[model samples]
Target: MFNNLGNLADMMRNAGKIRETVEKATESLGQLQVEGTAGGGVVTAKANGRLELLAVRIDPKLLADGDAELLEDLVTAAVNQALTKAREAAAQSLSSLAGGFPIPGLSTLLGPGGGGGA
Candidate 1:
């Protein structure tokens, strides 16, 4: 009978490669962009899978005088919206990369598809 040890070794090596690929893909998602808007699109925000803010946009009309409070609120709302989208994007991207298996320490880190423990 043919031994299965060689096949087992190959499978293990392949699994390692898969893990490496998952890590790389996770990194790539952070480099990718996910955008969100708030206050009827008066404010916009963007973030990556790592939940790092990349940019924000405010409508010129929202820059009028005596609108400091409104502006602040809009900014906050926009950022929160962006964060929500960012979380979704991260989760989807990481899930795609993971292919099904839960990532190691994923619950501890703030990466996508992982919990928000981080």
Candidate 2:
């Protein structure tokens, strides 16, 4: 029974370590930048690995043209693409840390596809 208790203690320690590693990884992920473009570069979107949209760029010509509908569509497309890239980067970063152990719920969080992209 003492041996079992020791094993449980070890498991708890390892779990704490894993949690710390994951926390650091998640924090760093927000610093990562990703860009996505649409309309053949007419519009570009930037985001962090946390999937937060940061900024957007529009070609001077597009704005000059004054096509509100087209501009809106392009902006939406760019933002969506940027978000996808951010999610992918965040997932990859997280998966690298979680891959070391067979932690319950971690697999599901990372997903079965294993690419770790949303």
Candidate 3:
């Protein structure tokens, strides 16, 4: 009983550590910026590992015509590219911090298996 109690306590402590690590990691992500471009750089977006879009840039040439469909596509591409960059940066950062230990559900957490994440 005592051993089990000790193990449980250890797990609780580990959980807290992991929480702290994640908090720090996410905060760091905001500090690091990753840029993603689409349509041959006609559209661009900047995001952090937290997938927070900090900025978006659109080429003036593309804006003149104002084709809603093309504009939408470019925006989508830029955001998607930014999201990919954010994920990559997050994975790299987590890997470095976790010594290559898997991030538990990050990959599966965001992919199709996410099952409607929060």
Candidate 4:
């Protein structure tokens, strides 16, 4: 009975450590940024590791062309690219926090590029 209680305590402590590590990693990730471009650099987007869109830029040439649909497509592509980069950065951060050890369910949680090294 005493051994079981000790084991439970140890498990709880490890769980606390994991939670702390995750929180720190998440906070750190938010400070990182990534950029993505589309339409041969006519459109660009920037995002944070938290996957939040920061800013966007469009070439004045594209604006002058005034094709609404084309501009929309370019913007979409840029945003998607930026998001992909953000996910990759996040995965890298989490992997480091895990000490490169494969954390169960972490890969799935991180999505496609959220595994292995950062």
Shift in Å, residue 3, candidate 1: 22
lDDT of 4 by residue, 14-113 (tens): 9878878887877887799999999999999999987889999999999999899999999999999998998888887788777655666666655676
Whole-model lDDT for model 2 versus the true structure?
0.77
| Runs in model 3 lying further than 4 Å from the true structure | 1-18, 104-118
Q: Which has the greatest TM-score?
A: 4
User: Alpha carbon lDDT of residue 66, candidate 2?
Assistant: 93
Residues 1-118, candidate 1: write the lDDT tens digits: 5586676566577987877886787788678787788889989999887788899999888886558988899889888777777777776667666654555666545544355332
Better of 3 and 4 by lDDT: 4
Ranking according to TM-score, highest score first: 4, 2, 1, 3
Q: Record all residue pairs in model 1 with backbone atoms less than 3 Å apart, i.e. clashing.
A: 90-112, 91-113
- Alpha carbon lDDT of each predicted model: 0.74, 0.77, 0.74, 0.83
Can you write out model 2's per-residue Cα lDDT over 1-118, one digit (the tens) per residue?
4866776667687987878887787688779999999999999999997667899999999999999999999999999888777767767777666663444554344334334432
Off by over 4 Å in 2: 1-12, 100-118
Clashes of each: 2, 0, 0, 1
Clash pairs, candidate 3, are: none
lDDT of 3 by residue, 33-60 (tens): 8888988999999987677789999999
